[model samples]
Target: MLFIDPENTPDFKRSLFNAIVAPRPIGWISTMGPEGSVNLAPFSHFNLVSTAPPVVIFSCNAPADRHEKDSITNVRATGEFVTNLVTWELREPMNISSLDAPYGIDEFELAGLDKAPSRKVRPPRVACSPASMECKLLRIVQIEPQRPGDTVSNVVFGLVVGIHLDPAFVDPDGRFDVARTMPLTRLGGNQYASVGPLVDLARPSPRHD
Candidate 1:
């Protein structure tokens, strides 16, 4: 087995860190800037952290020079954003929105994506996504810079205020058929994967329960 200190490791292997943390859900985040400009970007480090209050978190990397990414900047400014679920059919547009463009450039128009007005937020949602969550900014936690010229991590937590789901992906039982949605996820460098065949695994219980 090979072992190397992550912080002091060579630059060549830094990307391996993401590759090691395989199959992360893509947070197709959309936010409106202070000037009403729209921005869209994808983050691989995203996940749902709670069920009761419906908390979701995604992290953005801020370079030492270019600190505070556009998403973070917009979220801080507007306190509202939308997380759109990426589907197999919408993958190209999703990737298109990830383009790094000049500030104030509208990604929706750049990517040729139709926008749907969110119920409780100023930011718009991608019309072609299988589902979307309108979120209110809860808080942003900025981690200390690891080293000189290194990127700082801006961890943003959002509370789900509204949700929209395409009826086609819903099951008769009133639940989302996630597999049918063909959700796309990141898998290390230059790789992506889609939801596979469904598997049902019941949780084991103790006799006392």
Candidate 2:
């Protein structure tokens, strides 16, 4: 196996490493205000940060102009948001929300998605999603916060307050099976993938004869 230090690599080389971490799950985050203003966006730099207290995180990278993304801003404003699972059926609509648009324009309307009121959050959840998590802002850590002219980078963390799941996608054992959900994951560039074939194995006993 080839081993190399990440710091020694060039910027593009590091970026290449990120891209090669294939088929990352997309975070279809939605946030809104008490006044009804809303924003929806996708970020591949997202995953479950923990499960004990039900925490999740998604990084809102610094924009080209060194500004934080609207998702992070709105979550900070309202202290609540929802993360909808991106499935194969909703890939096109999900992509639509990724475009840069005016802050107040509801991406749900733009994507022609139906909104369902969240049980524990102000931000309405996407009705068509297989699953969605309502979250409260735990913290927003500004990674390498800007000094005078330095570019800003930030990572937002949340504690999941509630979860909504479709009955159709639930397994007999009460688990959210990815195969049944047909979830889509993000790949490098303009690529995305659906859930692939899965295999299972049994663990061996620790006793040595």
Q: Name every residue pair that clashes in candidate 2.
A: none
Model 2, stretches more than 4 Å misplaced? 1-14, 145-151, 203-205
Q: Give the true-structure RMSD of model 1.
A: 1.7
* Per-residue lDDT of 63 in model 2: 77
Clash count in backbone of candidate 2: 0
Report the number of clashing residue pairs per model: 0, 0
Number of the top candidate by TM-score? Answer: 1
The digit string of per-residue lDDT tens for model 1 on 159-208 reads: 99999999998889989988888889998788999987677899988788
Which regions of candidate 1 are displaced past 4 Å? none
lDDT (C-alpha, whole model) for all candidates? 0.88, 0.85
lDDT of candidate 2 over 1-209, digit per residue (tens): 97776545444253564578887888999999667798888888889989999999998666774267888778888889899999999999999999888668899999999999999889988899989999999988887843443356678889999999898878899998778778889877788989877888889779987
Q: TM-score of every model? A: 0.94, 0.88
User: What's model 2's overall lDDT?
Assistant: 0.85
